[model samples]
Target: MRAGTSPNSSSCSAWRSEAGPGVRCSCPRPRGGSANSISTTDVPVLPNAGDYTIGVSIGTPPQPLLLNLDTGSDLVWTQCQPCLSCFNQRFPLYDPSQSSTYSPLACSSKLCRALPLSACHAQCLYLYGYGDNSIAIGTLASEAFTFGSSNNVTVPNLGFGCGFLNGGLFNNESGIAGFGRGSLSLISQLGVGKFSYCFISYDDDDSKSSTLMLGSAADLNGSATAVRSTPFVLNPSQPTFYYLSLDGITVGTTRLPIPKSAFVLQRNGTGGVIIDSGTAITQLTTVAYKLVRSAFLSQVKPPVANATAEVFDLCFSLPSSPSAKVDVPKLIFHFEGADMDLPHENYMYQDSTVGLMCLAMFDSGDESSTIGNFQQQNMHVVYDLDNQKLSFAPARCDQL
Candidate 1:
């Protein structure tokens, strides 16, 4: 999911500031070429199911954080000391006082240049917004980072945010472990080289869980489908964005018949189908949005009127008739290289009122769309940078 100040808030402009002298921006700018072009790499054709999760550590004891495997962000941050208003979770807090290696970034430091602040004062603070309307703000600093299941490897001098206070869903989260491509992010710092993959599971309920693979590939159950990888545009001035050549979308067996021009690439550099674990719902463009929602409602028997929520564009009554079977066609997400099909559970939800409802499942706040946790459930998603491709495999998250 994308993070910044509120859409209407003037304070949100902090994301565009320029770095001062000698300080370098972590995001890589486009090198003057066609935007959608993929770099030269060996596109490994592997069977779906070899999905794995990347292990992210938060706090001093380094509690293992299971993230949704996102490619849209770069800075990996977590909750820390003085978390007076935080939510319930198993992770520990990072106490800045305890680590002798902890060093706050100077206002004039290159890292602070791109952030929105009145001045390059070392006292500036950074904050992030969540879907649940939670906010986390803190000073930026360099600390130690360790990855892997054995927890044997460690990377020192890692730049991360140490949030002292956070609001909303963030209170429940340790902090965000960003997986965007940049020098400040885990993938960039570990020298693991470019390319990592993520495997997400599809679950209708809490049973869903997924994996993120760093500098390696996870073991898929051998039923994975490979999709073409679109080049990532790293906007040096703002957050990173993942760009995929989305040809079209299909509901079950029927194609929505929407034009390809509807889904345009974002120009701000940070544009594309942003994959995020922290967000519970998925956001889509207006055209793709209408088609997906219409197809979902058509499948459910006894048509229900759309309900209004602050975020979601459409919601339907749970399918009632026991004889009424919701035949969700394999929702096909057509990228340039391969077409990926999502199972029924990805869009259908059993609600408290409506027994089963076809959820539009996403929101586009302004205009951009996001692929959040709800869509990632019950599927193994692989982000292979080495081969410049993305892969997917279905999983039994009901067992999670």
Candidate 2:
């Protein structure tokens, strides 16, 4: 996001001034960030299985629903009425009929045209798929979206997918709130070029919540910080995914001997490292994974190990209790211009259900590397889309 212009004032005024009447503005009172700059809205993070979800309301009366804040894809969608197939959800499905503000987009609409593979059948239909094979096939509709605790701040006529047929590992959440760099994404729709998020350790107290800020508040300027930023690589072919230049990783002081080209963008516009909030575990290329895994084992030597968890590559029994701290060294991710030192808890997970400690990273072959949300915990990460850079600063996420 660009700095200086306040989302609550100048930028918002510019946005609303362009739109004609009957469009209700729902801008919130700007919270102070640096005693002068507006602080970002803090949305409570709800723990769903291993994923982190935030509350979002849609429709006329603002029906409350929880959705995953995914940065990988671009489509803010929720399970709607007339489902052919859907996951068992904690909340009721969103019924567009109940909301007077809800309106379906036409096939010729600009929003529908922005979609990658939009289908026209009276209503603009869309088929959104995830890397996990989760598919959401539904109609594209626009409605008022309310965010934050008071639910007073809203974005009217926001484009979202009303998923009539959806299936995924969405445990209790309704659907995903896309923050990617696509035309129909919330970020693009709002025209806020900047956003930042601070994630807390999932295994920690559930009482504490994570934070996501939009607009000028997401800027690193006029703040006390140790922020490092790197240029974001945008592939015209895959615009939704935010690709970062990852040189190599370091276990404490020793940096791994991985080839630079191993993390480079391939001829197919793939094979670069991505910072994904939806993926629970971090994934590395096969060759890079082996080197890091071996380095981790040599440093953190745990005893009485067991079989790896269904997803995690490394798992071991805690010596004494679940709270017992493992002497794991800090994992430093060496990006092109930034060196993010991940805390021990950020890279390791303690399964409270089974009382086992495991490395929360895996090898997903040589397709592409991913820096998952787990590794992003306790870090103030700022995504500056306008500048095409990402900045990071280590902090206690709970405190932030």
Candidate 3:
């Protein structure tokens, strides 16, 4: 289910915007399977709207809904029955009463106090808000969570938000499955230790869905490639966010002349870099964007069209001939311990139907720099919380 809207959606502002296997998947279950073992061949994730969605079955009798998988947020919620203020959704609202496993949390429960913004009326009521002002206000409750349509795997007594009043640009996703590093997040509650996903390419029209690997399967897959790991930079004040050290960026062979301070995460938690699946495009700080914009434009071939958008600062016309190569230069991101030379399509969104090509990154002004899903297409990324590190390897996600 897609819920997040583009950052700075109202203006030129850069808008941008899992889990685990406590239980086994299709495989046989033990007290706990091997940490490196591929325990579940369970969930089927699809690219929905501009974001990604996965099938989640909640409740005892199994009520299924599509949920947005968000690494940027922490809270598993959906629009439940009795919507107080709900956005028009595509699927039927989740009816808690119909399920035998439904159980609301008490106000005094420690899980209810996990997030600072949560408040209690009679029971534990949570108020989850997004940077775009989208909010989900409802009760915090525990229910059985199942993955995949066949219901091969389930986690009983999983804590999640049952939204009664929710509104946002969800693209009709039922709600969100937050995979952030927060205690209340689905990933944390499941205690999967490690998880991984490979998003199907946006251009892949075959309509095939990808898998969300948990436990040892993700790590074993990592062992096969030219994988590189980067330590997660912690912001003590805001621990839920997965921050990384971005060393620098390069256009072709020339590194932009941006200051190192541009990417720093201050004590107040103002600016830093995060890998977000909710956002469609990459977003950079104003200081870095200006230098990168200048560098990219300086290298493009002459006769470039003056195409532009409210969010993206760079745009150009693609050659009319189908066989002609788009002359966009190679863009590279220098992370703390690795350099990712993005596929041409990853950094540049080529809307061939309109013969337009725009740089996939947005200028996020003074806000945090976001490595959105656009830059992560056809990329297999693994999050190892036990080691507190992030790893990546380029892959044909359609096949994964």
For residue 211, give model 1's deviation from the true position in Å: 3.8
Off by over 4 Å in 2: 1-42, 220-225, 308-310, 321-325, 351-355
Q: After superposition, how far is residue 232 of candidate 2 from its true place, in Å?
A: 0.6
Between prediction 2 and prediction 3, the one with superior TM-score is 3
**TM-score between model 2 and native:** 0.85
Off by over 4 Å in 3: 1-38, 149-151, 220-225, 308-311
* lDDT tens digits, residue span 231-281, model 3: 898988777788999989999789888788889898898898988887778
- The models' CA-based lDDT, in order, is 0.50, 0.75, 0.74
Q: Write the per-residue lDDT of candidate 1 for residues 92-155, one digit (tens) a residue.
A: 4555665556777776665556444323344646765544565667787776554432213445
Error of 2 at 125 (Å): 0.8
Q: For model 2, where is the 10-residue window of minimal lDDT?
A: 1-10
State the local distance difference test value for candidate 3. 0.74
Distance from true location, Cα of 273 in model 3, Å? 1.0
**Against the hidden reference, what TM-scores do the models get?**
0.70, 0.85, 0.88
